[model samples]
Target: MEYRITDGIVEAIIESHGAELKSFKLLKNNEEFMWKADPKFWGRTSPVLFPIVGGLKDGKYIYHGITYEMGQHGIARDNEFKVISHEKNKIVFLFESNEETLKDYPFGFKLYMGYSIENSCLSIEYRVENISHEEMYFSIGAHPAFSTPTSENIEFSDYYLEFEKNETASRFPLEGKNISRNTIKFLENSKKIELEEDTFKDDALIFKNLNSKKISLKCKKNTRVVTMDYSEFEYIAFWNKVGAEFVCLEPWNGIADFVDASGRLEEKDGIIKLEGQEKYKAILKIEIQS
Candidate 1:
């Protein structure tokens, strides 16, 4: 089912299945942006990461001396979440590992996601519990794609990212996909790039070793803006298609390697493990201004 929660400053639409956040509308000083969720293209505020974020070496991972097959971005993002509790400004959604998930994850676990709106910020909290007798492992993240320039009529090329600091980002070169091993050019100044669908002609620009926590998307004219402070997350991703008005500012706890990885889960970045009956949590918050 779909549910709505609000605290006057912000409003959120959450789906119980998969604990997905369908919409996050920032009510700015008495006006709403009217965020919408398309039933056909509905995606979690950001897709959830679990047993794996991307494909393991050949779609298999080495665990306990055995190999298991997994797909891209795990399965939790599309699953249905159960509404466990709610109040005026907070809502909690839960998902328990089941027989179906076992086919892909092969682990016993419980995932609880909470969405809270207070004033102008939205706080996302994630809790994962190991339900098996032995230890279990996983990864978590947020993928909220916010509308850039805070206006619909503007072209994607009109948007520019403003970093809190003058720090430059480092790009990780992708291999094993017929793509060459070369680092992508990082944006230093406020530059503009035209958006073209089917472009991205190359692979995704992977970034590692970042130290900044805040980034903003604004018009080249600097009239409209939306910002995100992800100081808590280990990394951030900036991506959009050619002509995509929306920009996806992703905050991740981990990332997947090229398809031809060495089939070692431990070697993967940001992989976490929990002892029997233990739990882990990660939180991300977003503040928007118009």
Candidate 2:
């Protein structure tokens, strides 16, 4: 099922499958700011990553002496979510652990994804609760893809991502989808990165420590801009398919396994641990201007 909400200035469409945001558009000009999910490039607009983010070392992990098999980004994106609440400009979806999930995750939990629109900004919030008797370990992240250029006259290369503050962060390149130990200087005292076709040749640019929590996408010839604020997130990622017309700004509270992982979920890098009856929350705000 799909739900829609509009706040005079912006309208959004969210589906129940992943409780994912399928579309975000400006009401004044009827211009879409979200990706169209082109299968030729990418087929998702915004997907919720839970229990895990990115790929495991070998598509497997160990928990409490038992080996579990899980694919990249976990199963949240493919699972169904229940609509818990809906308002004129806000909606909330809930996903609870079941028998099938226990086979791979072995934990009882509830994930709530909420979307709200106010004026020109859209807010995406996630709340995870541990329902199991024992402590639960997991990861959660956001993958929201926005259309590049925003205007047909502007080329993708003319666009760039501007950070709120100057940063000198290192990029951890991926090794066949798995996290690698090698690090390279990505942003050296620069606040913006010009978009290029080869930017994602080696997969997503994962940054562990960044000085900025907000980033804006801008084009040289276009006045349209999109800003993403993820103050509560611990890590950030940028990615796009080669020659694709969209880019993803990801805010992650947890990351994937290392190339040389210990195979234990508890020991995985950037994993979140929650005791019984505990909850965790994160927020991502996206603002569009033209």
Q: Pick the candidate with the highest TM-score.
A: 2
lDDT of model 1 at position 47: 65
Model 1 misplaced stretches (Cα beyond 4 Å): 28-45, 149-153, 173-182, 185-203
Candidate 2 ranges beyond 4 A from true positions: 150-152
Encode model 2's per-residue lDDT on 1-290: one tens digit a residue. Answer: 99999898899999999989998988899989888899998999899999899999889999989999999899999999999999999999999999999999999999999999986789998999999779999999999999984355667889899999999989888888688888888888999999988988888999976889899988888788999998999899999988888999999988878788998999999999999999998889999988
lDDT agreement of model 1 with the native:
0.66
lDDT of 2 at 271: 94
lDDT of each: 0.66, 0.91
- Alpha-carbon shift of residue 256 in model 2 (angstroms): 1.6
Give one digit per residue, the lDDT tens place, for model 1 in 1-290: 87888888777777776676667765665433322433343333456666565545566777667777777667887788888899988988888999898776778999989989887677888888998888777877676666543356555556666667665555655464212235576655433333444334354555555655677766665555566777767766655543444666777777765544566666666678789999888778777656
lDDT of candidate 2?
Answer: 0.91
Evaluated with lDDT, which candidate comes out highest?
Answer: 2
Which 10 residues in a row give candidate 1 its minimum summed lDDT?
30-39
